[model samples]
Target: MTSVPTVPFHDGQSIPQLGYGVWRVEDDVAADVVAQAIRAGYHHIDTAAIYGNEEGVGRAVAAAGVPREELFITTKVWNSAHGYDEALAALEESLGKLGTDYVDLWLIHWAKPTQGRYVDTWKALIEAQRQGKVRSIGVSNFPAEQLEEIIEATGVVPVIHQVETHPYWQQRELREVEERHGILHESWSPLGQGGELLEDPEITAIAEAHGATPAQVVIAWHLAKGFVVIPKSVTSERIVSNLAAADVELTEDEVARIDALDREDGRIGPDPATIEF
Candidate 1:
């Protein structure tokens, strides 16, 4: 299997470009699904306490027999656990559930500005990284203003910023801000949360040109743009097909054609700024 290139973090670490996201996957089925993803060549697995499938992921990780160092594991501290001590405790709990001593990447889940404690939680993450409890630290769903606030308050730029990104909602301006800070951008809904991007005429045309699936074309677009994408799927065939995207190369013009699909107002998820928690 071809390996996807890794993007460096602010802390001088690297993360695989293509990963497996276990979001919305039920606990009962998460282990088998994750095992399939691993068998399909996914080395990076993204999960969180809020997902409620950490134990299953742990089982799969152990069962896969892939050495711990060979896999990149990431999890987040949920919004309800936003204070310093609470965040620390939540990390311990997550570690327990995932059957790991330290996570490769730990994130602040959400800005949770309404809670007014993300700064405190970020401080805890910094300490956790220093203690080697986490190899890297970052934030998710952080807007530019909130991200700046975190940097100014903690004097630590996030290693990466995970956000809802797809062709329709490319987040170009926010990505520019992240680039200014030398932070990698990781896309959560890399496929538009199961929307029609995979079935769009433009995507289909590109896929037909490459003799690949529309999903492969979409994943190729993300890879070409240098964004880390964690696409989720429980189906064995889809998992294999998604990983096979690493081999599908898109020409610059083809990428440009896909970029034209971006819309100024095409977000498929809730705005992080307005989310209550």
Candidate 2:
């Protein structure tokens, strides 16, 4: 098994820099798919209640034969669960679905700023962490302003901020804010969900220079920049190849070349500030 490298969170716990993400994966197929990821050397798994596959994921974990402590699991509460009480209840349901006593990381799936209850949801995450139901708490799709508001409101900084980021959308400013706050930046759609920029000549050239796949080069770029990256794939080959990216290293110049691919219009996901659900 390939030993993935880990990034240290402020809480002194470490997370595998590379992990598997199950976004649109179906509940029925999630177990087999997740089992494949485990066989591919991936130790971290990212799932969410919105994905509708936690039960399959739970079954896979129960049968994978790896000790629970040897794996890292993460799940998020959906938009409806935006208040403190709802967030806590949502976590319980997720735990029931995931068949795990606790998750390594639990996150507010989205700020859902329009609802104005993320701060309350964050408070629930804090309580869960304090009660040992979650080891760490974080948020997803949260912009810098929302991140700051929650931190200021609760005096608790989320250990991570998972967002839509790839070479084409590096999120430089958001990353800067996270760095200043000592929060880890976790990348979703890390390989460009639609294969955006995966075929760029610059990226291809870098791949050639490093004798690696374009996906590996892209994943390596995230790691070089100190971001936790989870690239989703149900295909067995792609799953293994994604984890193998931990072995690929990019030089400063190569990394810069990829960084230059960032564009103002590169965002592939919804704007966090305006999202209602």
Candidate 3:
């Protein structure tokens, strides 16, 4: 098995460069899926309150036999819970559902700019970190401006920013901002969500040349670009294979070729600027 490397955060902790996400995974089966992922060499698992599967995820973590300190578990606060008091309560509820005293990282699921409470929520996250309830704190689908606002308002910087990123919807501008702030960039829909890019002639050709699947090549591209990639799958073969993709080496030319796939109109997820949810 190939070893997945860890990326350093500005806050003195590191996260696995590759992990498994339980976004659309069913609650009834999330335990088995997460356990299988752990058996396949994944020490990191990403989940959230909105996913409706934290209880199952906690069960898997407890039964996987891996020590609590060895696993990196992350969860998020949903859009509805956006104020300081609500965010604090939200983390407690998530902890109860997850059956854990603390989470490795916690994120505000979305900016919800219309409501304009992300800043207050972020302050709550800072409080969590200070209280030692969360080791790290961040936001998902947040634009650079929002990131800056929270950082300027409070000196704490996010350790990571989770968003929809792929060869098509490459967030070059957002990546730059994260780099400036020393925040790790995390790819949510790293595989393009079954889009045509998965079957594109270029990706297939690259896969054929590398003797790997298009999915593996795409994941390898994400790692080669230094972004944390979480590709989810319930199938046993795919779960194991995705973890082994850490070893699929890509050349400079191949990485650059994939980089060219980014398009201004290629965003498959909602625009962070206007997204109310």
Identify the candidate with maximal lDDT.
Answer: 3
In order of appearance, the predictions have TM-scores of 0.98, 0.98, 0.98
After superposition, the stretches of candidate 2 with alpha carbons farther than 4 Å from their true spots are none
What tens-digit string does per-residue lDDT give for candidate 3 at 33-120?
A: 9999998899999999999999999999999999999999999999899999999999999999899999999999999888899999
Q: Name the lDDT value of residue 58 in candidate 3.
A: 96
Instruction: Estimate, for each residue in 1-277, the C-alpha lDDT of model 1 and write its tens digit.
Output: 8677777887878899999999999987999999999987899999999999999999999999899998999999999999999999999999999999999999999997777898999999999999999999999999888999999998999999999999999999999899999989999888885558888899999999999998999999999999999999989999889888989999999999999999988798889888984
Give the local distance difference test score of model 3: 0.93
What TM-score number comes out for model 2?
0.98
How big is the RMSD of model 1?
0.9
State the TM-score for model 1: 0.98
- Judging by lDDT, tell me the better candidate of 1 and 3: 3
Residue 251, model 2: Cα distance from true site in angstroms: 1.2
Q: How much is 261 displaced in model 2, in angstroms?
A: 0.5
Off by over 4 Å in 1: none
